[model samples]
Target: MSMKHLKYCPELNQITGSINATILLLQLEYWFAKMTGGKFYKFLDSCEHELYKQGDSWVEELGFSKQEFRTAFSKIGKVYTSKKAFKESKDLFNGKYYASYYDRIKGLTYYIRNDAKLSELFDDDSNKILYSEEKSTENTEDVLRTPQIIIPANPKTSSPLSVEYNKLLTSVKDTHPTKVCVPYETIKALFNQYCPSYPQLTLLTAKRKTLLKKLWYDMGQTLENFKQAFLSAENSDFLSGRLGSWRASFDWLIQEDKFVALLEGCYTNNRRQSQFSPSTPSAPKPHSKFTTMYSHYWDFEELEKLEDQYIDRQIAKYSTMSVALD
Candidate 1:
């Protein structure tokens, strides 16, 4: 199935998870509209884009009158803007003016081009804004030229991971018969995301079951805490196998003392200390051809700075050579 990139702010769900269903839909619609048409459409006078049309005609196309559109936008905007999570995070709306439009187009195009059967939570039918074939045929060529974006079809059925997760959840509840049960898939997804370099381990394993039970039940740590602790372990040079063959694994994460230490930020703080302090003299370890070295902490900004310095040096060297030739 094809992937149409949608302008999704994941933090929106996090911030507004408890909001009313109708209000949630209103927010989504506003986000979709803002994504298709530029936010500058709100102030038509200053919009420099050639594709931007004058007046309420553009707004009308979104199935909302001027007043209704404004109200919808305002209501959702207030909900999100008031949220600390939303305020702390950045999204398409935070960057360039045209970001929302492009994101909406990509997201729309994804569903249109891909298979249907998306999850009920994010069904494609809910996003039926436009891009019908009859009109699409006429506007296909110009659609690319214009500011408009194609809203893709939704394949809002069950995904393999979701099915597996749900199945696991039901099984766990049945077997344990407990009042408290952690969502395995959520924690698994978080681990995969935050610790990409680590080996992909499944919670369905016997060892993993024990580990998760310890973290979730025995410790009473929330999913968020587990995620942070996982990140901490991943960032540790010693624990992640950077310094030696001894590296922490999924099973190691649940060790009673180790897990408690990680939760207390001891591991993360130690890693930070190592980064800032001068390296101490130590015995050199044997290195094999297969022993791959990775950065202890890779920072994008640091890499960018190094890249800029390299580019400047190249430019200066080239200028000197040109002068010599002259």
Candidate 2:
């Protein structure tokens, strides 16, 4: 099963507990940035908040004590520069007594995007584990063989799926809906990309089709938004796990609040703006007028009592009129 956090690292297999905790802590930091649409530099910023405590909680969840967590971070400088766990790259940040910057503001991003180690952990099958060399060969072949269709440079204006979407769909699902005569190949491609272990979507199930339709028409998210969210989830350690693996999924992501939350960078270091502060900002909120203004103010309990009395009076008047007529 896919894990929301990296529970095991081959490098930490035979390391001291302190070193293991340190490496795990670093991975947790990376995972935090991945979930949020922000960079890891935010973690190293001067701003102080509960982010460290949150990391501690994760360490505790991973079967380490809070003291160990604290000690790991405290000793990070000594251990990291010692060339113990990860070898220091030639790239250096001009800080006193520091070699490679732990923040890795740009280098980490470059690696995650380019380095094979950070990208795909296991194959799609979830059964077989391929070595880095073998995986690289397969990836190269897949790229060369994939159809070189040019995705529109400005997909937002065109409101169309990206080249990545087209390649993913043609490779996997490739469904064409007959009833609507409007093929939703884009949605199919997203589902396939989001959940590759599922059977190829030659046809979408009724439930799946309705969900896709509402996500597009009701939610009003374009194919580009879908593509971006898919990539975000793909990189997130918490969301890309297979269904029933305690990680978020495509369906969860499509929810109104969840989609907006992901897009807003709630999970990322961009959330520093919402951190605890001495005084809260008085920014005007959306729909504030709706909450502030009301045409009439009636006490709910009084209104209910008045309504019941009016109903009784009407019944009595109707009874008297019937008697008089009789």
- Give the top-scoring candidate (lDDT): 1
**Tens-digit lDDT track for model 1 on 124-144?**
543453212233444332232
At residue 285, candidate 1 shows an lDDT of 34
TM-score of each: 0.29, 0.24
Model 1 segments more than 4 A misplaced = 1-179, 269-326
**Candidate 2 global CA lDDT score:** 0.38
lDDT of 1: 0.42
Candidate 2 positional error at 53, Å: 28
